[model samples]
Target: MPDVQDCLPTALYRAAQVRELDARLIAAGTPGFELMQRAARAAWRALRRHWPQADEVTVLAGRGNNAGDGYLLAALAQRAGWRVRVLAVGDPAQLGGDAALACAEARAAGVAILPWSECAPLTGVLVDALLGTGLSGAVREPYAQAIRLLNASGQPVLAVDIPSGLCADTGRVLGVAVRAELTVTFIGLKLGLFCLDGPDHCGALAFADLQADPRLLATGVPAAQRLTGAGLPALAPRPRNGHKGLFGHVLVVGGDSGFGGAALLAAESCLRSGAGLVSLATRGEYVAALLARRPEVMARGVRSANEIQDLAAAADVLVLGPGIGQGAWARSLLSGLGALDKPQVWDADALNLLAAGQLTAPAGNWLVTPHPGEAARLLGTTTAAVQADRPAAALALARQLNALVVLKGLGSLVATPSGELYLCDRGHPAMAGAGLGDVLAGLLGALLAQGLTMTAAAQLGVWLHACAGERLGRAGRGLVAADLMTSIRDLLEEHSPCLK
Candidate 1:
């Protein structure tokens, strides 16, 4: 299990919440300057650790506390006799309080402070301290150009906190954002640094507590939970006396004719993930292929609705819509399955069908995983709108469908109908390939069959799937869904404790 250092708070607060925490800490006797100094030192330590040999450091300082952090970091570098320069992006005279003190300290340490200029010769490491999480609107004027130049510098950049033009509440980039190779965030873990463009812009992320009182931090609200593998639910190992029927059955519906691989992948996930009985109802043409791939799964080649009725009736869990296309045959099959009141995990075209108003989501324990575009369709909005506010969008879908909704993205959000929300930030970008969602749906269905509730199944399934992606992603690109199954079993084995 990974350390709980990443788990800060589940409630993502605005920039004001962080400020309030700072104020509360100061009010409780800790001097504001002391806290600022701690943050600077924390960032400096991370900087040195990340770029040990880089002697030249360009600190782009603004007029706020964030700049104070940059200035102090520059002072630390200068004191070490490293070639450090503070390219003040904002008016240096405008800096006040601890920030002003930090600037004076940097100057005293022989770190040259210069005004923002195109000819500043930004070489080596560029530290972005221009706009913090406080900025709400699009980055304007000189700052925007500065961000552009910093991005073009090709020098490995480090953002002081959140990236310059990213919304701290939502990971949405404020028009343009600086892409940092490393981002050292302080105080509390901001939610915006994990979702949307946050993952892309924040590169390798590091967090510091600034040695603030944990009690004061407890009083502060969290903006969002950072999902890792630490808090995942454990599936106990099967006992010697356990039988195949004890684990429950999972029925997958999809793969009309030519798209049989989708259903096969879903069934395979369920079969491998510990489902006692795994079955697939698909086109007859694919039956031999599915059996050839995994003989354990009971593959039924169903061309009509009648061929699936009995199977749907007996399924402990149903995985719907992985390549079930929107044709008449697909519609007829789903319509029949929708009438059955069983636990379901819907994905891919099934979600698309619901978004298109072709059918209503069936009642009972259900989980729906949709990407941003499908989520937008479900919410009757554009994909941009959905991406801008994913947390809200996930909640809305959960309420509308009366099911667990997993909004798939950088930080996958799982929202239950009961207003409960869970986040899974464990996957790698290599999992962005095809058949991944099918694998997720099958895993979730297997969990449901194994007696986990809709929410638990969804959350656990997401964590397992994402963690597998992260583990296998080390090989980089061209990660196939099948590669994750065995690795997932290995992880599950490490997680599950078996008593002799």
Candidate 2:
């Protein structure tokens, strides 16, 4: 499939939207059967390219258009002198329209079709075509049993359109989903394929538009957009005479006694991410360590919220949270910053405090980056509920709080108060560490300080952060949060060069 992650279309749609696009394509002169044939050919080509040595095939067919694609592919493989057989999970008599025509074609080509049984003796690359994107409920009966067997078969598998039992809208597994080695999706890209459980089940993804007209496809609205390097907002180049004062000052307020590293990581990221002046308002004891670590940062030990007034007034933006515990000191610091009118980026304990009702969110010009757990608290729901439909959760958080929101996770989402949603499909498992969120919070503050709008900063900061982690993640396990700082700085320069 050639790793089409960067080349895929950014506009992601729900299942119904994709069906609408398919209908439009069919209405515009292309026969439905012809479209099915094209889809089959696309999947066939991808399969051949992916598994060139495999000469035999076993297809699990269910009576839908998805099964039609499989039947047609089986016919193609049969004609090409390869052994092919179809285990009809969906009764052949139940097939209709294009699917019925496809089954007849397979039979005409002398391909063996048999009923699905518990002991089907599966062999050769398995093809999953049991369900299409129209699936909304959990799998039932024999199909679920077939899916379980396919998963346990220990054979390479290819899913037609979408993997059966995987929600095409929310990537949530419905009872059981076929885990395919390669998934060839047709028409439009489903939002579920890139987020939540989608990536794990879909494996290597390949998309085929089925020759649909670009104009017709553009008419439909997208549910959300996948962030790509070319489409992201960029920072302008700095002038030759630009100095420290030209870029805004960023004040990082957090770092309780025990979790001083969290606040320091944020301050360091801010300094490296082009914030002209970065100041840290943390515990008195950590000041010496921070200064010794990064003397460029103006690190100060403040005992109370009253001590932060002068610093807050002088700063252009504030990055609150990282390492701020839920103790009295943290609460007092958060309470003091509540009245400040500056643009702020809140993370970690700041979100916790707000979720606990200890702090009332300020009116505007602020953003919050929270993981699923924190987001659940903010929404008065469970983390599992929040993760079930991340797009909805992020949009709801943005609208409810009336603030820019970055729901951080595998497929991190950036949501605006106006309901615009952007998803970042970058980053790797290697980034599953403690201090990464702190670094992201700092990076967001730096972008805001450097004059990017809250929306632009959130989107660009997330892209940079994810891409940096992805690049560093190449080294594999043991990727520390500090490892991302230098890579992010380089990526930022590459994304928006220092010089024009």
Candidate 3:
């Protein structure tokens, strides 16, 4: 079996979409049973490689074809002269088609087949073949019990296709899912694997296409495009004659009172991400500190909306609301910018103010970066609801606001007004602290100011930000918000150098 990690698939599909692809493959000459065998072989190969010394196996089997994969794997283990047991959590009498055939083959091969009971000893490497991509609702009845047992087994567990009791579409834990050490997914890459609860449940994911026809795959459109080095778009190369004014001016307006650092972070990002001229319109008290910190930026101590208006008039792009509190000052800035034609990126409290009805969502040429909580506020929903389907929430935000949306967290989703969605599955947990959003907002501003379209800026900024975080996260833990600034420029140059 080939290592799926080496040759990764960029297109992600819903569970139903993967099932459709499976049906299409079966229709295109590969038998369903044969595909199941291929899947089992892939899982077995991954399992052996993962736990080479663990020969003994306990497979939790259900009624569906997922059970078929388990049964077939038990037979494969038996043939390899390894001890194997198939605990039938699903009634064997109800097993149908390929699954029934697989059960018969496993039994004839002298594999120990026992009805799953509470007392069944879960030993060696546990195989979670209980439920696959077909699960639509909560893990019910005996399957739920089996999933609980598999989780509690405390043994090395390998999930077939996906972790049992996890939603294949939304990555929602369906009444609790198996905590598999390795999850071998088949056919197509499911969208649920990287977002929400998916990453928590799926320890490590491996994909096997089961030798599907390339022509068959060509007929299907992906639900969302995955952002990778191979597929990402970067800034175009700069000519040797490029100068400071060539990249456009960026105005970062935020940093109310105590949150002065938020605005400064964005300002630093502007200079780092190739913004030719950067201006900062922040609280009066922060001016000396910002100017001393970064002399490249023209830091202004803006007392009123009138002063910000003067800066907004001359700037090419605006990054608003890094540390802008939901006070009189924030409202005045929003009202002043209401008439500006410049492209903008709004984040942090800007989203909060928008959700709170204090600010109007701009029509177009603006990008909004919101975490789940901010997204929920903007959508008039709860954080749980937003997390349930992040992709959908992102799209809704874009459509409702008629602006480009970056729903930040986990697999950060970028949605455009034209209905394009891109997922950046980069970044590290170490990059999960305060002030990150401010950095992202500032980076987005620089990208847009460099003359990238709303979609291009959102996508590229997110990729660069996440990729930088990933590169720096190697140091391990305590990754603060300000750490991303310099690496961003390094990566930007590496990815799309200014000079040819």
Among all candidates shown, the one with the greatest TM-score? 2
Q: lDDT-based ranking, best first? A: 2, 3, 1
lDDT of 2 by residue, 1-500 (tens): 01237868999999999999999988898999999999999999999999999999999999999999999999999999998999999999999999999999999999999999998978999999899898988999899999999999999999998999999988989989999999999888999998899989999999999988899999999999999888889999999999999899999998998999999999999999999999999999999999999999999999888898899999999999999999899998889686689999999999999999999898889999999999999999999999889999999999999999999998899999998999998888999998999999999999999999999999999989998988889899999999999999999998899999
lDDT of 1: 0.84
Q: What is the lDDT of residue 249 in candidate 3?
A: 97
Per-residue accuracy of model 1 over 168-247 as CA lDDT, tens digit each: 87799998999999998877777787778888998888888788888888986464455555666667667889988999
Model 3, 86-182: lDDT tens per residue?
9999988999999999999899999999999989999989999888888878878888888887788789999998999888877888887999899
Q: Could you say which candidate leads in lDDT?
A: 2
Which ten contiguous residues of candidate 2 have the minimum total lDDT? 1-10
Residue 398 local lDDT, model 1: 88
Q: Lowest lDDT 10-mer window, candidate 1? A: 1-10
In candidate 3, position 5 carries an lDDT of: 38
Q: Whole-model lDDT for model 2 versus the true structure?
A: 0.93
For every model shown, what is its TM-score relative to the native structure?
A: 0.93, 0.98, 0.97
TM-score of 1: 0.93
Residue 151 error, candidate 1, Å: 1.9
Cα-based lDDT at residue 436, candidate 1: 88
Best to worst by TM-score, what's the order? Answer: 2, 3, 1
lDDT of 1 at 4: 34
